[model samples]
Every structure is written in C-alpha cells, then in structure tokens.
Target: MSKEVAAQFDELAALYEDMASWPFRHDIETPSVIAALGDLHGLDVLDFGCGSGLYSRLLKRSGARSVVGYDLADGMLGYARRRAEKEGLDIEFVSELQPRFAGRFDVVLSVYVLPYATSVRELGEMCGALAGLLRPGGRLVALPIHPDYQPDPDYYQAYGFRLIPDDDHDRPPRSDGARIRLELCHGRYQASVHAWYWSRATLEAALREAGMTDLVWRDPSTASDPAAAAPLLRAYLDRPHAALILARKA
Candidate 1:
C-alpha cells in the first residue's frame, strides 16, 4: 500500500465516527481482547493504530491509568487529540511510530494494522519495535486482517479508496476452486478491480518469523464460524473479520 492512500484515512478521520454509524464500533472486537489480557485498572496502555480514538475512549471507561494513542495518519491523530481535549480525557497522541516508546505501557493494543504493512520484513520490524518497547511480561495484543480476507476488494478500498491491489508478484497456481473477489466500488455506478487472496500458511509463517510465540488464533464471531465453512475455502474465505492473535514478546 502507498503512503498516499494511508493519508486518505486521516482525511476521513473527522467524520469517521459519524459515517460509521453508532454500531460500527471497533470495540466489537475489543472486549474479548481486554478480557484475555486480564487486569486493566491502573495499568498504562497504548492503543496502537488507534483510529479516531474510539478504542481509547473504551479503554478509559475500562479503568486504564493512562492510555496513549498512536497512528500513522495525522488526520486520525488530529481527531484523537481533539476528542481527548473535548472529553477531558488526557491521551497522548503519537502521530508516527517512533524508534521506541518513552514510557513502558503494561498493555499494547494493535488492532487491524498488520495487513497494511508493505512487506513481511516491515511486519517483522513492527513486531520488533513493539517487543523492544514492552515492559517485561507486558503483553502485545493485536488483531491482524486474516490473510483469508486479503482477496476482498473492499479491504483494499478500506486502506485507500483510490488504490488497487497489486497482483504482479509470482505465486504457484492453485489446484482448487478457491477464489475471492477484489471488487472496487465507487459510489453506485463506478467500480474496478483489485488483487485478491493470501494464504493462511503465509500469515502464520510471518508471525513465526517475527519471533512471536504463545500464539492463539481466534476467528472473530462476526467474521464467520470456522466450522461453518466448506473445506475448500476454509483457509481463505472461511473468515471475513479480524483474527485475534495474542502473542508474547519473547
């Protein structure tokens, strides 16, 4: 993905909450994560890839001592800071990923960030940065766009409304009938194409290469139940939502 498209999200930041409607809450997947993370009271927390600070607000209500919001998009961070100020919630907004976090946070929440990474090396570096910043025993809880959902064109537009998925990379031909659409929709009449499909094994391998362990994968309930899929598409189209990956720094 281009940095240009990443910039688009920031532009949409101000109206994101309203445009999403009330039920489009990112916290739809947050509660289960927090529960698995255990205690939050008085613990310092970081909302990595914090978008519009919705989860940051949720963290405050859950009793975190201090919650800092970080994101790559300035527009999102702008909204976060404004929301913090208006609500009398003190949240430190870091507009870009720094070499290291200045203070130790007990919990780090990285939701829907990995898929946007440009490469496997980039993903590894991100994990390394998080690992280096975490306090010993502090957990790094993240939700990755399941490689399964990579084929959907809507996923590409979500990253940048104008961009299309690149399919020039070489890969082996599939022996099965599995396929995912990369439909690019623009308003009611305009639409185009984008690349679709990433394998589950590749995703797991990336995590392993990043040195992440204690891996536990939970398919989001809203995404679709694992047992509900036919065997052919089970690895890719079986899940449509986020994949909860709880990995330890060590």
Candidate 2:
C-alpha cells in the first residue's frame, strides 16, 4: 500500500469506527465476512488492515484463540488499540507485519485491503505477504472491489455509500491500477478514500503466484433475520461493490 493511501485512511480513524454500526456494514458486509471465516473457534487469526479493530474484536468474540490486528496506518492501529481496550478485549493491535509473523497464523482476514494496491506488482506482493503470514494450509479471506463493480457513483448511494472512478472526466476505469473513489456516509457521518482496481484474472494470478490455491468467490449476504429484513439492501447485495475471495496457502 502507498503511504498516501495509508495517510488517507488514517484521517478516517474515528469515522471508520462509527461505520461498524452503519446499516450497510452491519446488515451486509460483516455477515458475509464472518460466514466466509467459517467457524473461527479456537483458531489463531490475523485481521489484516483491520481499521479500528472491528473484525479483530469480532474474530476474538467468535472464539478465535487469539486475534492480532495488523495495519500500515498508525492512526487506525492507535484507534483500534483504544477501542479494544475500552471494550476490554485482549486482542493485539500492531502497526507492522514483520518477518517474525510469517507462517504464524491459522487464518488471515482482510476487509477492503487489496484495493489499496496501486499496481499489479504491489498486488502480488500483498498476496505473497498475506500468504507468508499463514502456516502450511492456512487460509486467506479478503475483500476487494468486485471486478464487475458498478461504475455509477450513485448506484450505491442509497446504501450509505457511493463509488466513482478517479478519472479526470468521470469515465469508468477499464484497466488494473486505475484509481477509484469510495465515499461512505450515514446520518451525519461521511468519509472518502481512493482505491485501485484489479480484475478477477489479475487477482487470481496474484494469489496463485503467491503460493495460494483453492480460490472461491462469495457474494455479499445478510446477517439479518428475514422477518426483520430491510428491503433496500437487496440491490446492493445483488451487485455488491466488493466481494470475498477465500483461498489457502498451497
């Protein structure tokens, strides 16, 4: 990830935490991620790019034996440490992912991390780094902008967010490494950040080259009870901006 990307997210530290309870995340994103995690019981998990430690706390609460939240943004890590402490969770939050952590986790989970890669080489390095963090046969559960992402900035507006290509003229980005703008908003909270685009073919190639295999893609699903469902989330789920990629170290 670029220093600029990390710096941008660092500014969203507080707003990032508030997003945990935002409708889109609460009803859609988290459930899909947790389901992809599939039985965290007694597992040692790494919450990669864990902004404000949301998933880190969730993984621990889900019965993971230990959860370590790692991120390049010191702002996010500091806020995460504070949140984890305030909530009395024993999760460890770190600003670095050093060699000492290689092959040390049972699972490495990331939410909205891969898109930060500004180039194919960076993407491959990212995949390799995450792969190295895992032990033999360990899994990686990641979220990246779906290759089929909607180009209309307003398409997801009703779902508390919007996306638009970061181009001089508002045209859709058709190549890898093109920048995109992501804006998240709730009643009175709003934040925006830039992320790169990576196609499915490019992504899979990176994973495979990183020594990861058994790739699977899962669409977003609700954690809400059907009877208590909110209707508008359907369109977003059908064409989620991001998707889950599950794989294992080969």
Candidate 3:
C-alpha cells in the first residue's frame, strides 16, 4: 500500500467499523461475497484486505475451520484484534502475509479492495499475491468497484450517500484513473473517503497473468440470495454498482 493510501485508511480506521455496516455493504456486497464463496465448512479461509476483521468474524461464524485476516493498516488491525478478543473468536489478523501462509488456504475473499491498485502493474502484483496464497483448486472471490460505474444522482439520494468525482472530468486520462469522493451519513456519524477506479479489461488481464482460470463476471443480483437481499438486488438491477469476480487457481 502507498503511504498516502495507508494513511487514509489509518485515519478512517476508527470510523470503518460503522462504515462497514453501510447498507450497500451489509445489504449488497457482503451477501454477494458470501454467495460467491459458498460452503465454507472446514475450509481454510483468508480475508484479504480485511478491515477491522468484519468478514473474518463472519467466515468463522459460518464454519470456516480457520480464518485469517490480512491488511496493511495498523489501526484497522488493532481494531480487528480487539474485536476478535472481545468476541472470543479465534482469528489470526496479520499486517503482512507470512511465508507459511502460501498455498495454505482453501478460499480467499476480497471485498472492495481491488480498486486501491493505482496502476495496472500494482493491480497485477496484488492478483499475483492472491494466487500465491491459494492452493491449487483454491477459489478467489472478489467484489470490486465496477469499471463502468458512474454515480447516479437518484441512486445516491435514495441510498443516503453521495459520490462526487474529484473534478468535472468524465473520465481520467491517465492510466491510474481518477479518484472519487465517497461521503456517507448514517445517523449522527458522517464520513468521507477517496476511492480509485480501474478498467475492467485491466482487472481481467491481471487475473489471467496470476494463473487464475475460469473467470466469470457475475451479475450483482445473482451474487446474492434474492429473498434476503431484495433491496440490494433491486438497487443493483436499477443501476450497476459493483462487479463480482470468481476465479480458480489451476
């Protein structure tokens, strides 16, 4: 992680737990991520880019034999550690991937993390790391910001959040793309953060280079159970928000 990016997360660490519960995450992203990663019983799972170990706890509760959460931010890791201790959940949270972890997990889950790759090379490196951590036949499921995502005014109004481009530019001219400011107000708390965007082709190429195959672009609606995620599904169908990537290590 770049110093700038890491600093941003460090500052947001305290607010992240609440932010993680944003309707889009709890209602949409989480369900999609879980559905894409079906049947965790006795599986060794890793929550890549896990912030505050939210999904790590979920994976443990869902019956993963062992769950490890990895992230670059110390503040987030601190929160994760405290949460795990308080909840009495046996989860290992680490800031770096140890050598012993290579080829050890049955599944790797990443939600809303890929876009942090500011460049194509960086994106490929991240993908390579994910592939390295998974054993042969191990699956990777990730939910990244959609490449074609454009903020809709109505959707923002309905969702109680706001997405504002850094500038008036419709698209970024540089290879790294532009940043967008995301602001959310839930009850008395309010928070804002900047997020990057990358092209879909760039992501696909990175996955291929990482030796992952059978890449499938899943529709967000199909990524979750309809009955349980009706509002999220409806919102996704109304306007595409995030993209689900399912790939396997060969």
Candidate 4:
C-alpha cells in the first residue's frame, strides 16, 4: 500500500504544480500552514514530506538560512529541483534518508505525511525519527487529520461518529457537527485509508511519549472562520488537509 501511494505521487509529479497552485482548489494545505508559520528568518529548516517543494520555496522566501526537502516521490523531487534551479534558490532535495541529518535542523515541518502510516506503531517510529532529527529546543511543526473528523468504521459507522459544535480553542472539542468527505487517494491499491484521527489529548500523549513537550495545536484558519460550515470544516480537516502542531525538543 505504501509503495502504491508513492507510485501514485510519482506519477502525479507532472501535474503537481497545477494541483498545488491551482486557483480554486488544491490537495495539500499549503496556505493554511504558511500562514500559521508566519516568518522563518535565519531558521535552518528540514521539510519532511515536502511534496513539490511549495513550502520549501516559501521557507526560503521567508528568509530561512537553509532549507532541505525530503520526500518519497521522485516526480515531486524533480519539480522541486527544477523550481529551485530556476529561482536560483539553494534548497537541497534529499530523496533518501541520511544518518548525517540527525540532530541537524532547527525546525522540521511535516506537512501531510501522517495519514499514510497504517498503524500507531508506524506513526510513532516516523515521529521518533523526526524528533531525533531536531536539535534540542528546536521546533517541529506537523499537520495531521483532526480526530473528530476521523472515526473507526468498525465502531462508529452506525452513528457516523459524534458531531458537536465548538468555538473555543481548548474548551471546545473539535466541531463534530460537520460532515466532511475524505477522499483517500490510493484507494485502488489499498482499502480506502481515511484518517488516523487523534484528539488534542491523544496527540499530547503521543508527543510526550516521544520525549516532546510544549505541544501547541491550532485550528485550520478555515475552521476558525465563523462563516465556514461544519461540513466545510470537516472537508478542510480531512481532505489533503493538515492540523498545525508545533512542539519543541526537550
């Protein structure tokens, strides 16, 4: 299933620019994240699962001292390399993992990679490796599926998962009243993998277990907007969407 997902993205490289920068819609949550990140001056960043190098370029333009992007898709990497070249940006594209990168970065950003992990164990390993790559006091920012939008079909298919409206940051649980459609990309190869959702409590627990603390969770901008409906929030949360999580290395 993992291999097939990568293959699909490898084939998607040619169309990635259009898909990523499309005016009306896009699969990845680039705008939500970039807005959340704010500024990146003098930061040394490692972009984990940086597809098509969109965020990588943004980081450089934000004045990052150095930016390196890693991804499983060659097609994305090719476009990334070319874009970097044409723009004269000195971003590094590493297609494979390197031991030397351990503890080398001031910040690590994983935009949309967590859902691909088939299990919690795998997710732990992925997070652990990313944590190991961070320097002490360095930050790691990630976007994952909001747990409210994700319910186990085996358990919640009857009621379609709990839905409740929320407005507060910590006081309110995820706005569950909305019905969001999550389109699993590699459904043909793998039984449709929706979302391995995790609540704020669940996320904090996992990060603490990995020896990370000071976790900060923020709602996607679209979610906080009073104008957005529950279903749209759910769509923003589930679709190639991202939950911005920031934590520091202890």
Candidate 5:
C-alpha cells in the first residue's frame, strides 16, 4: 500500500467500525460476501484488509478453524486487536505478512481491498499476494468496486454512500486505474476515501495472471431476513456499488 493510501485508512480508522454497521456494509456487503464464502466450518481463513476485524470476527463465528486479519494501517490493526481481545477471539491481527505464512490458508477473504491498487502492476501484486496465501484449491472471495456500478454519483446515496469520479469527468471511468472518491454518509459519522477503478476484464486478467481461476461475479444482495431497509434496497441491489468475486487458486 502507498503511504498516502495507508494514511487515508489510518485517518478513517476512528470511523471504520461504525461504518461497518451501516446498511451498505451490514445488510448488503456482509451477506453477499458470506454467501460467496459458503460454509466456513473448519476452514483456515485469512481476512486481508480486515479493517477493525469485522469479517475476521464473522469468519470465526461462522466456524472457521482460524482467522488472521491483515491490514496496513496501525490504528485499524489496533482497533481490530482490541475487538478480538475484548471478544476473546483467538484471531491474529497483523500489519504485515511474512514469507513463512505463504500458502497457509484454506480460504482468503478480501473485502473492498482490490480498488486500493492504483496501477495495473499493483493490482497484479495484490491479487498475487492473495493467491499466495491460499492453499492449492483454496477459495479467494473478494469485494471490489463493481465493474458495472451505477454511473450517477448520488445513485446509491439512499444506502449511505456515493462514488464519484475524482475529476468529475467520466461516469463509468473510461479507463482502468481511474481515481474515484467514495463517500460514506451515515448517521454516526461521514467520511470519504480514494479508490481506483478496474473493469471486469482488467480484474480477471490480473487474477488469472496470479494463478487464480474460476471467476464468478455476484451482485450484492439485501439481507434475507427482511431487514428494515429491505424495501428501500431495490435500486441499489439492482445496481450496487460493490460486487462479490469468487475465485480459486489453481
């Protein structure tokens, strides 16, 4: 991660946990990712870019044998460690991945992590790293900014967020690695982060180059148990800002 990107995450650490509970994340993101992950029982999982340990905790709760949460920001790592300690979960939170840990997990889950790669090579490295952590045949489930996300910046505002081109120029981002701004609008707090855009072709090429195969892209689904916002999610679900990607290290 770049110093600037790491700094942005550090700055957002204070609001990260609260942001995790917003409808966009809790009701939409979590469920879709969890579904893509399927049964985690007995799986050794790695939660890459696991800010605040949200998905790490969920992976354990869903019966993963072990979970390791990795992130670049110290503040986020500290918050994640505190949460794990307080919750008495044995998950490990680390700011770096050592060489000794390569190919150690049965499943690798990365939520909203890919967009941080601002260049094609960076994107390849990110995907390569994720692939390296997985045991042969292990699953890699990720959430990247949807390749077909709604163009209008305010289209997803009802779900507490918006994605606008950084330059306010092209709507779908005319090219790969285009910069974009993601705004989080919620009752607890408001925040924004910078991310890059990658089309399905670009993302697939990167993953395939990293020895990953069997790509499946899924749209975010609303909570199945009739969440209060269930009625308000038709549009976003149809044109969600994020997508769940399932693949395997071959």
Candidate 6:
C-alpha cells in the first residue's frame, strides 16, 4: 500500500468500524464476501489487508480451522488484536505476511484494499503475494471498488455516501493512480478519505500473470441471502459500486 493510503487508514482506525458499519458494508459487502468464500469448515483462512479483523473473527466463527489477519497499519492491527482477545477468539493478527505463511492458507479474503496499488506493477506484486499465500486449489475472494464504478447521484443520496473525484473531469474512466475522495455519512457521523483506483483489465491481467485461474466475477446480489440484498441489488444493477473477484491458485 502507498504511504499516503496507509496513513489515511491509520488516521481512520479509531472510526473505521463505525463508518464501515453502514449497510453497504454490513449488509452488502459482507454477505457478498461470505458468499464468494463458500464453505469455511476446517479451512485455514487469511484475511489480507484486514482492517480491525471484522472478517477475521467472522471466519473463525464460521468454523475456519485457523484464521490469520494481516494489515499494514499498526493502529488497525492493535484494534483487531484487542477485539479478538475480548471476544475470546483465537485469531492471529500480523502486520506482515511472513515467509512461513506462504502456501499455508486455504482461503484468502481481501476487502476494499487492492485499489491502493498505485500502479499495475504494484497490483501484480500483490497478486503474486496472494498466490504465494494460498495452497494449490486454494481460493482468493476480494472485494474492491468496482473499476467501472461511477458515482450515481440517486444512489449516493440514498446510501449516505458522497463520491468526490480528485480529477476535475466530468467522468473519468478507470485509471491507475487515479484518486478519489470517499465521504461517508451515517447517523451523525461523517468521514472522508482518499483512495486510488485500478482498471478491470489491469486487475485481471495481474491475477493471470500471478498464475491464478478460473477467475469469476460475482455480483453483490448473489450474496448468501439474496432477499436481504434485494434493495442494494437494485442500485448495483444500474451501476455496480464494488467488484467481487473469485480466483483460484493453480
């Protein structure tokens, strides 16, 4: 991750959970991630770029044999550790992906983190790291901001989110290093952070170069409970706000 991006997250570590609790995350993204993950029984799961270990704890509760959460920010990892201890959950949270963990996970989950790659090379390096972490036949499920995402006025108004593109262009196509301001408003709280963008082709090529296969794109609507995703689906069908990539290590 870029230092700028890491610093941005570090600053939001205290409020990350509260801002992430918005329906788009709890109701839409979480279910979508879990659905793409399929069964977790007895699997060694790794939550890459795990902020506050939300999905790490969820994986453990879902019967993962072992769960490890990795992040770049110290503050985020601290929060994750505290939450795990308080909940009596046996989760290992690490700041780095040590060599010992290579080829050790059955499933790897990354949520809203990949876009921080400022360049295609950085994205390829990330894919290679993810590939190395997974055992043969292991799966990687990632949720990143949709490369084709466009700010929909109505959707933003209804969902309490404000999209502020860094570029002054009316509507710019997906590009590496493109920055955008993501503003969130839930109840009385409001927060804004900048994020980098990546194009779909760039991501797909990187995954393939990293030796992944059977790539699949899953829509948010196909979450574990379609009924619960119905309302969110309508907005997504018009213009997807996120991308779910399911790939397997060969």
Backbone clash count, each prediction separately: 2, 0, 0, 1, 0, 0
Give all candidates' CA lDDT scores.
0.59, 0.87, 0.78, 0.64, 0.86, 0.80
- Lowest-lDDT window of 10 residues in candidate 6? 221-230
Score candidate 4 by lDDT: 0.64
Q: Which structure among the candidates has the greatest TM-score?
A: 2
On lDDT, the stronger of 2 and 5 is 2
Deviation (Å) of 172 in candidate 5: 5.6
Question: Which pairs of residues have clashing backbones in candidate 4?
Answer: 163-176
| lDDT tens digits by residue: candidate 4, 1-250 | 1555555577555444554543213322556677666677888898998778887988898899999999888888988899899999999998765687988988888876765554566667777877888899888888776554433322222212222222233333343222223332321221222333445565666677777888888766542443453554444444323467888889
Model 2: colliding residue pairs: none
For model 1, which pairs clash?
Answer: 151-196, 151-197
Give the C-alpha lDDT of model 2: 0.87
For candidate 6, report its TM-score: 0.89
* TM-scores of all predicted structures: 0.70, 0.94, 0.87, 0.71, 0.93, 0.89
Q: How would you encode candidate 5's per-residue C-alpha lDDT over 105-127 as one tens digit per residue?
A: 99999988999998899999999
Question: CA lDDT of 229 in candidate 4?
Answer: 38
Query: Candidate 2: where are CA atoms >4 Å away?
Result: 168-171, 223-229
Worst ten in a row by lDDT for model 2: 167-176
TM-score of 4: 0.71
Which regions of candidate 3 are displaced past 4 Å? 167-176, 222-233
| lDDT for each residue of candidate 3 in 1-250, tens digit (9 for 90 to 100) | 4546755676556566776676666676677678889999999999998887888999999999999999887888888999999999999999878697999999999887887776677788889999999999999998777766656534664455666666456675222456666676667657776666766788888999999999998856644456665674476555666789999999
Off by over 4 Å in 4: 1-5, 22-29, 150-202, 222-241
Ranking by lDDT: 2, 5, 6, 3, 4, 1
Cα error, residue 88 of model 6, in Å, equals: 0.5
